[model samples]
Target chain A: MALDADATLGEAGEFGLISQLVAQLGEALTDDEHVLVGPGDDAAVLRVKHGHVVVSTDLMVEGRHFRRDWASAEDVGHRAAAQNLSDINAMGGTARHLTIGLAAPADLPVQWALDFARGFAQECASVGATVVGGDTTRADEIVIAVTVLGECTVSPVLRSGARPGDVLALTGRQGWAAGGLAVLGRGFRSPRVLVEAYRRPEPPYAAGKEAAEAGATSLIDVSDGLLAEAAHLAEASGVAIDVRRDAFDVPEPLVAVGAALGADPMQFILGGGDDHALLATFPDTASVPAGWQVVGEVRDGEGVTVDGSEYDGPTGWTHF
Target chain B: MALDADATLGEAGEFGLISQLVAQLGEALTDDEHVLVGPGDDAAVLRVKHGHVVVSTDLMVEGRHFRRDWASAEDVGHRAAAQNLSDINAMGGTARHLTIGLAAPADLPVQWALDFARGFAQECASVGATVVGGDTTRADEIVIAVTVLGECTVSPVLRSGARPGDVLALTGRQGWAAGGLAVLGRGFRSPRVLVEAYRRPEPPYAAGKEAAEAGATSLIDVSDGLLAEAAHLAEASGVAIDVRRDAFDVPEPLVAVGAALGADPMQFILGGGDDHALLATFPDTASVPAGWQVVGEVRDGEGVTVDGSEYDGPTGWTHF
Candidate 1:
C-alpha cells in the first residue's frame, strides 16, 4: 500500500516508518549471499568471506553537513554513505554491509526517510554492498550516522606506510564539490556539473584495491582536501610531500566556475574536499596503478608543500 | 599531558579533541590481538576469528535519550555502548570492536567528550571489545551513534525459531531502569540503586550465549519491556506467549518507590523497559539454563498475555 504523501513520522510511527524505509532497500537487502541475517532483528549476521574486516563510521548532522533546503533527502543519504564507504575503500577493502543510525524530528515526512534509504541503498549498490540494519529515534534535528563493514583480500593499507621517494597518486575528481559549493553559495545553479557534484560525490571505489595490488606504499582518502590529506599522510609516515602545480591540468568546468567567481582554480584542486578521492603513495612512479594521476612526490620532511613552497590558501575543512 | 578543563571543542579543534578522546581508549586500542589496525587510520582492520560477524548500530540524542543534567558524559557513553553491545550479546555473539559517530555543538566542553570516550572504552573493556574508528563533527546537540562488530561461534539464535511449546525464560532484572526513571523524575535521588540503573543498564552479557548453548529456540533483547519483547517473539515465531505474572517478585526498592508515588510496581515490571534483559525460548524446561527464570510458555496463537489476559497498562515505548 502506498503511504499518503502528507504522512509524517509522527503519524507513521517508528516501526511503520522503518518498514517503509526498509522497503526502499529492495534487492540490495537480500541479494547479498554474505548476509546471514538482515533487518528486524537484534543484530545483523554476516558471513565474512575474508577473516579480516575493515570498519569505519561517519556522522552527518543537518545544517552542519547539509541543509534540507539545498539538498534532497536522497542527497543527504548518498553523502552519508559515501563518507564511511570511502573510509573502508581507503583501506583497500570492499564494502559488504552498512548499518545506519538516524535521528529525526517527529514532523519529518515519512517519504523523505524512504527516499533517504533509497539513496543509501543505491550508493551501496554501486559498490556491491548492502544495507543490513539500523536504529531510528526522535531528535530535534536530523542526524544520520552510518557504519560500513568491508573485507580486504590483501594486507590493508595504512597511512603510515609511505616513505621518502614515494610517488603520490590520486584517483577521482578533486575540488569539484568545492567549486559546486561556491556556485551554490553565489545563488547561481546554472552550473549543473558543480551543483550535482556537490549533491553526490562519485568516489573511485575500485582504485583503492587496484592501488593496493599495485604495491602502494600508503593510501588515504582525500576527504579533507588535497593539502590537508597530504599533510596527514606526511605526518603519519614522517615524510613530506611536494605537489607539482604544473602536473594538474585544471578541468574546464572548474576553470569556468573559477573565472566567473574571480577565484583561482588551483586553490580548489589544492584546498577543496568532499570529493572522496583516493590519495596513495607508490614506491616509484612505475608502480602507480592505471586510472590514477601522479600529483606529487614524497620527500624526507614533515609537511605538505605546493611547488616546493607553501601555497597560501585554506588547507582543509575543520568541523569545529 | 592534561588539557584545560574549561576548554570547549571549538577551542581545542577537531584533531586535538580526537587525540584526547583516543587516549581514553588506552589499552583497549593496542591490546586486542584480533585488531590489525586501530584508530588514526582510514579504517580499523580486524581479524575476525569466526567466519561470521554480528553488527548493530544505535543513536542516542541529547535530551531525547538522555539529559546532561541527569546523565554524566560518561553515563551517556556507557549507555550508548551498552545498547549496541547488548544487541550483539542478544545474537549470542561476543563483541569485538566499536565505531562511534559523535556530533556535538562547538561550545560543548572538551572534558565532556573525553569523559564520554572514557565511559565508552570502559564499557567495551567489560566485554573485551575495543573502540576502533569513528567520525566526529559539529552539530546543535549531542548525538552519539555507536556500531558494534561481534563474532558468534555457534549459529545465531533468531526470534523466528521458537515453537509453540517452547518455554519462555528471562535473565537479568526487568523494569529496574523504569523504576529508576520514575524515582528520578520525582526529583528524588536517594535510591541510588534505581537512579544508577537508570543511568546505565547492566545487561547480562553472558546470558545470551548461555541461552544459545542451552538450545534456545529463539532469543531477543527485552529493551522495549518484557511484554512488548515477548509479543515480538510471538509475532516473529507465529506463536502466542503467556507470561506468568506470578513469576516476578517485586523488589524492595520498586515496592517502596511505587508506594511513595501511589503507583503499581507490577506495572513497571510488565510495561517498563531499558534494562536490556535477555529473553529467550528453550525447547523444554530442562533446556533452560541456570540463572534464567522460567517466565512463561509459548502457545498456539499470536500476541502476548499476562496470566492469559491482555495487559491494560502501556505495552512498551514508542519513539514517535
Candidate 2:
C-alpha cells in the first residue's frame, strides 16, 4: 500500500508531531521549587544556588556514533546520557538537569524511542539529574543531542591552569572502551570484560570532586586517549608533559583485547579513547587519591612525550 | 595531489584536533567571573544572576536540512544560530550565549569550517549573544547542532495556560518561508521576497517581549505553521480555537509565491512552517502591539476550526 499522507513529514506536521511525542513523556519536574519553568516554554529554567552553572553538550548520531546492530536503543540512550554527565563530573560539578533533542525516522518503533528514554532516565538517576526538556523530530537517521546543566560548590577545574613542574594523575581505567570496541568490531561474542566496558563506562565521579577539593590545577576527561588529552593540557597551559611508560597499570580487559588483536597493551593505554577517566594536573606536593595513579609530570617543554621521546601509534579518534 | 593523511581527522586525532581548534578560539570567558572553569575540564561553568535562564537547541544536517549548493557555510551557520536564538526570543528572553557541536568529514575544507564559525559569531552578535563553547569531531557528513542560552528578567512565556475567550494574536508575516521554499524548489528566480524568507527568517523578537509584558496568557513560536501551533494551545489548554480567515492579512511575498506555484495563498498562511512568528493568547482588553494581528479566539471547544469549521487542507508538518 502507498504510504498514508500522514506518514510523510509534510503531512502530519512538525508542531503536531512534537506535541504528540511530548505528551508521551510524563512530567518529571513538579510545578514547585527547583524548577522555575519546565517544558513547553522556549526553554526550561532551573533555580541555581551557587550563582555558577556548569554546562556541557554531546551529539550521538546513527552509524557514525553508534550502530543499532551493536547497541540496543536503551544502551544508546544510557551511553549518551552518561558521556555528557561525565563531562560535568570532570569539572567537579553535579549534574542537575538535562535537555535532549532527538531526530529519528518515522518508521522506527515508538517502543525503541521509549526504551531509549527509559535508559536516559536511569542514567540520570545515577547522578541525580532529571530530564527537564527536549525536542523530537523526524529525520532519515537517529540523532540524539543532549545538553546537561550542573552545579558546582567550589571553583571549576580548567585546562589552562597547569603550571610547570606539576604532577599529572589519572583516576579510572584507560583503554577499556577502545579495547571493547575492537572486540565488538571483530565479532567477538565474549560478554564478560569487553562487553561490560562497552555497555557501561564508570567514570570516577567522586574522584573528580576529591581532585577539585585537593586543589587540582588542571583537569580533563580521558575521552580521546591519555596522550591525546595530555597534549591538550600541555597546549592549553603552555607546558610540556612527559608520560612514564612504567606508570601504567593496564586493566585486565585491555590486556585481553591486546592479546586478541595481537596489539600492544601499552598502545591501548596511551592512545585508546572513551574511558571517561579523569586526568588532572596538581602541584608536585599534592597527594594522589587511592584510585588515582601518578602517570606523568608537566614541564616547560612543548607537547606530550613518552619517556622524553616521541612514541607514536594511533594518537586517538579523529572526527574527519 | 592526494590529501595528506595528517590533514584528515583520523590522522589529526580527536584529542589533538579539539585542542588545536579550541586554541584558535582563544579565551572568551573571564578567568574568574563568568567562567569559573573554562573548556578542557569535564565541562565549563558560567555565573548567572537571580533571573530565569532560557535555553533552546537545533540541529542542521547536510543534504536533509540544507543543500550546500543552496547555502554557503556562512549561511548555514547564520541560519542555525538564528533559529535557536529565535526560540529564546519567542519565550520573551534575550539571547546571551551559544554552544555549538559540529561534525564534518575529515577531507572537508578547513576554510569552510572557519567561515561557518565566523557566520555563527556574526549572527550571535546581532542577537547580543556570544559563541561560548562547543565540540567538534569528524564524521562522514556535516552536522551543526547549536544550543543557545538566554536570560530574562521576568518569567518565560509558555505554550500552556491559555484561558477560554482569549484572543489569539501573531507577530510578523506567516507563510513567507514556505513560499520561499516553493520558489527555490521550483527553480523560479523572479520572486526575491520569497527567496529572502527561505534564506533568513526574521522573528519578531521585540514583539514577543512586548506580548509577554502585555499579559499574554500563553505564547508559542510559529516554527511549525499557524494552525498547527494554535492547535497546540487548544490541546494544552483543553479549549477550542476558531480562526477568522477574513482577518488574515496575507503578506505580498506569500501572495506572489502562491500565484507562481498555482496554490492558494491561504494554504501558505494556514499550513506553511518556519516563519518564526510569535503567537500568543491575550485577554480581550489587552492592547495588541504594532506588527501583531489578531486572527483567532479561544473558546470552550476541543480542537481548532477555521471560520468556525474544520480546515480540510494540510494540517501542518509531519515527522515520519
Candidate 3:
C-alpha cells in the first residue's frame, strides 16, 4: 500500500490516489464517534445530536485563490478548510464534518494530493471535525470545493440580528493576510509572519460560540475585510455601522511591513481579506468577550462608515 | 432585477450575478421549512428531523464530465444534481438540501449561469430538496461541485451488508446513457430518447426507500457501469456476484443503435454507466420490491462474473 514518491495522479490512478488521501486522514475518519458511515460508500452518514446542522460551501481555484509557487499544497488545503470552517463559526456552530470535491490535472503529483489531505485533516482535528467524504475528478486546473457541517447547541447566530446601539467587536488576525499578499506581490518574503498568515489563516474557532453564548446580536466571518463585511452586516440587519479607525492598534510587524512597502497599514485592517476574523455585535462593550476588542458601533442609519464619514479605499475583492 | 440576456458574468459583476441566480431559485429559497436560513448568509441552517444526515459530494469538470457543445448548461446542471441526489437515494434517504460550488470563466454568459441554477432547482424540486447555499468564483473552465444532504427515516443502507444468497436487483435506466454517448460519439443524433437520456438521467429515487423497506441487504448507485459496481459490491461485502446476461432485455433504442453501429447491445446493458441506476442485494427473491428487476445473485466467492464467465469489454470510466 506504500505509494511511490515519484508517482503522479495519472500514475497512481483515481482510486489509488483516493486511498492514499483517505489514509492520510488516519484516525479522524476511523475513530470519529459522530460518523455513522465514512468514505467508500455512496454517501456518508453523520449523527447530528442537536437536530440542527449548520453547513456552507466555498470554492477555491488555483491562481485565483492561491499559487503553488507561493504556498505548499498543505497550505492550500489548510486555507480551504479554514474558510469553510470560518463560515460554520460565523453561524455560532461547532464544525463537525466536511466533504471536499476536488478537480485537478492528471499530472498532479500524488504526494501533493496526499499532503493536501493531511493539512485538511489537521485543520479538522483542530475543531473536532472530520473529513467524512469527497469526490475527485480531473480538470485542467486545480479546483477545490469544500463543504463543512456543524452543530449548534443554541440557536445559530445570523447576520441579520444586529440592532441599533449594538457594540461591534472583532477577534482573530485582521490584516496580516493583506500584508502578506502585498509582500508577495512585491517579491519580498522576509517577513515570514505575514507570508505565513496568507498561506494558512488561523481563525478564532472557539470565539464564535463564546460570542453566541454572550448573547451577541449578530456575527459574521470577516473574510472580505472589516469595512466590506461590515457593509454586508449593515445591509443584512438594516442598520448602519461606524468603525473607529483609531481603535485598531496595528501590529508592529504590519507597521514595519507598511513602512518598508510604502503602504498604509490601516487600509489593510479596513480593506484586506483572507484573515477569517470573527466580527460580532454585542448589546454593549461590557457584554463583549474578553478576547474580543470593541472597534465599531451599530447605528440606525444605513451603510458602513469610518469615523462617521465615507473614508473610501479598496474595500474588498470581487470574484467576477 | 432584470438580467440582460446578452450580459456576461464579468459584465454583470459578482453580487449582481448572484442576486440574479438567487432570484432564479424563486420560492424554493423562501418557502422551505427545513431551511432556517438560506443563501446571503455566512452559512445555512437545516433542521434535520431524524438527527441523522446522509451526505455525499461529486465534482464535474466541463470537458471531463460534460461538454458544452453536446449539452446545454441546463443539462449539465441537471446531470450534476442528479448524480448527487442519486447518492442520497442509494443510502435510502430523502434528499432535503443541496449546496453547489461553481467555478467558471468570467466571460460566461449570465443567462447560462441563470439557466444552470434553474435546471439545478428543477432537479432538486423533483426530490423535495432545496438549494440552501453555494459559492461562486472564477476558473479557466467550468467546474461544478455538488453536495447533497438527506434525512433517513430508516437506518441508512451501506454497500458492505450483503450476504451470500442475496438477490441482486436493479432499478431505473441502466444503459441508455451509454447508448446516448455512443450515438453522440459517431456524429449522429436521430434517436432523441437515447440522447436525452445521456443529457438528463431519471433515477428511480423512490425505489430506494422501497428496497430498504423490503429488507434489502446492501445497496449501491450503479454510476460506474453495472459490472464495475458489482465488483465493488462483491469486494465490499466479501462475496461474489453473478449476472445473468439473459436477464437483460435491451430497450428498442439501444438495440437499434447497436445494430446501426455494429456493436453489441449486451455490452451497453452490462458495462454502461452514468444512468445512476440503483443496484441492491435483497435477502431473498420474494423480498425484492415490486418495481425492481432481478438481474443477478450474490454468491459465496469473490469478484463479478457474467453468465459464469468474464465478459471482456470496457467496464467503466476512471477519472485519472
Candidate 4:
C-alpha cells in the first residue's frame, strides 16, 4: 500500500488515487440533524426546512478559460464565484452554500490558493453565500469547478414562458466587456467603463427578482450576446423576436472603444457578451421596473431579426 | 452573423462564440407555471414544489480523469453520469435532472459526442434521471463537467451524525476494484470478477435509501478506502473509531488477485477504494439491514484504528 514517490497517477491507478485524495479532506459535519451522512457514503445528505433548493455551476480552466498573466488569483476566484452566483440570481433564488473542486499543479504556491479562497469568500459574502465545502487536488493546470446551492422562497424564472407580442426588456448595459477585451488585446489603455466591465461583471441580481415579481413572462441572462439570447428566447417560446436598432442606447464608452478599435459599436451592443444583463420578456402593458429598458418585441416570425431584417454582422459564439 | 468556416473561436471572440452556440440549443422547458423566466436574463428561474432539492457535481478530464484508449466514448459517458448520480443517492435524494458542460478539441469526431450523449441518456434512464441542459465548448482535452439535480421527499443523510457508541456497518464488498485494477495492470486473465469490478462499479443504490429509512446514525459511501472513510466518519462525528479486522469478510476474488500479484490482501481490503459501498454507523441495538455487516465500533478516541492499532497502509488518494 506504500505509494512510490516517483509513481505517476496512471501507474498507481484511478481508484486508489481517488481514495488517497479523499482521505486528506478534513471532515467537519457532525451535527445529527445537520448532516445525515458524511463523505464515505454514496451521497451526502442534508436537511432543509422549506424543501426548495437553488443550484448553479461554473467551470474554470487554466490557459483557455483564464490566463495567469491577465488576472490575479483573486480576480479569477471572484469572477468564478460571481458568475455562478449570478446564475442563482437568474433563477430568482438566494445563494446559501457552495461546494468547490479545485484542480491545480502541485507546484502552485499554496498562498495563491489561499488568495483564491479569500476572493471566493469575498464574492460569496457579497451575495450572502458561504463556502460550505470543497475538494482540492493537483493537476497539469488549474480548473475550478464550483456549484452553488440556493434557497428559493418564490417561483424561479425560466426561459420558456414568453408569449407572442411580449415586450423584450434588458436590465444593464452590453458590449462593455467585449470592448474591454478589444482594448486589452491591442495593448491599449482601456476607458474606465470598459476596464471595470472586464475586471468584475456586474450581474443585475435585484433586477432579476424584481422582474419575477413584476410578472415577467420569460427571462435569461445576456452572458453571451443580446441577439444570441434573443434567439434563445425566440426558440424557447416558439416565437420570433424583432430588435429595433434605434432602441439600442449604446453607452459612450462602448462607442469610444469601437472608435479606437475600428469596430462598430452596434456590433458590441447586439453581438457583444459577458455583460450578465438580465433580459426578460413582459406583457406590453406590464409596468417596467427601474433599470430595465425596452429593447425589442416578440413577433410571429420564428427567429430573431434586427430592424425588420436579418442581422448579418456576426451571429455570436459557438463552443465548437 | 455569418461565421466563416476558417475562423477560430478567438477570432470570433467570446461573445460571438457564445451566441452561435446558444442559437442551436432549442427550448426544452414548457410548463407555464414551471418557469417564470428562461435563459436570456442574468439567470433562469423554475418553480419548485414544497420539496428539498439535491445537488451534486463531478469533473472529468481527458487524460487524468479517463483514458480515451481504455474506455470507449460510451463508457466515459456512463462513468461520468454514474458518479454524479451516485452523489445524489448519497444525499438520500432521487436524481431528476442533469446539466453537463463538455469541453473538447474541435477535431474530435462529432460522432463521439453523439455517442457520449447516448451513453449519458442510457445511464440516466437506468436511474430515472434526465439530461436537462448543458454547455459545450472546445478545449485541448475532453473535459466533462456534470451537475446533477435531485429531489428528496425525506431528510437528506449528512456525514455529521455518528455518535459515540455507534456500531459501524458496511453494505457492500471492498478492495475488489483495486484488486481488479491490479489484475488488469499485470495482464492477468484468470479472474473475471476483478476485471468487472474495475469496469463498472456497483454502488449500493437502494441500500442508501433503506439506511435512511432505518434511521442510520451516519452514513458515507466508501469511495475512498475503508480505513480512510472510517477516519472521515470518526472525524466528522468527533469520536474515535475501531475497525475490527476479524469482522472483515474479504471476497475470494480479491484474495486470489492479491495472491497472484504477490501483494497483501489485508492492505487491499483496508486501503483499496472505489467499491462505492454504503457505510453507516448506527446504535449498537439498532437493527442491521440485510446487506450490512457490523465491522467496527465508535468510541471516545479521536481518530481511526484497525483492531486497536493504527493502519500504516496507503493513506488514501491525494489529488494534488
DockQ of each: 0.88, 0.51, 0.92, 0.27
CAPRI verdict on model 2? Answer: medium
lDDT at position B46, candidate 4: 40
Chain A vs native chain A, TM-score per candidate:
0.97, 0.90, 0.98, 0.84
**lDDT ranking, best first:** 3, 1, 2, 4
- For model 2, residues A88-156, the per-residue Cα lDDT tens digits are 877877888888888777676656676687778778777777777777766667778888888888777
- CA lDDT for candidate 1: 0.89
* Cα RMSD to the true fold for all candidates: 1.3, 4.0, 1.1, 6.1
DockQ for model 4 equals: 0.27
True contacts kept of each: 0.92, 0.57, 0.97, 0.25
Model 4: number of backbone collisions: 55
Model 1: pairs clashing at backbone N, Cα or C within 3 Å: none
Better of 2 and 4 by TM-score: 2
| Better by DockQ, candidate 4 or 3 | 3
For residues B177-247, could you state the per-residue lDDT of candidate 2 as single tens digits? 78877777787754777667766777776777788788888888877778988998888788999988998
State the displacement of the C-alpha of residue B42, model 4, in Å, after optimal TM-score superposition. Answer: 8.2
Give candidate 1's chain B TM-score: 0.97
Q: Best DockQ goes to which candidate?
A: 3
Listed in order, each prediction's TM-score against the native is 0.98, 0.91, 0.98, 0.83
Better of 1 and 3 by lDDT: 3
Model 1 lDDT per residue over B239-279, tens place:
99999999988999989889999999998888888889999
Candidate-wise lDDT, in order? 0.89, 0.76, 0.90, 0.69
Q: Which stretches of candidate 2 lie over 4 Å from their true place?
A: A1-33, B1-42
User: How accurately is candidate 3 docked according to DockQ?
Assistant: 0.92
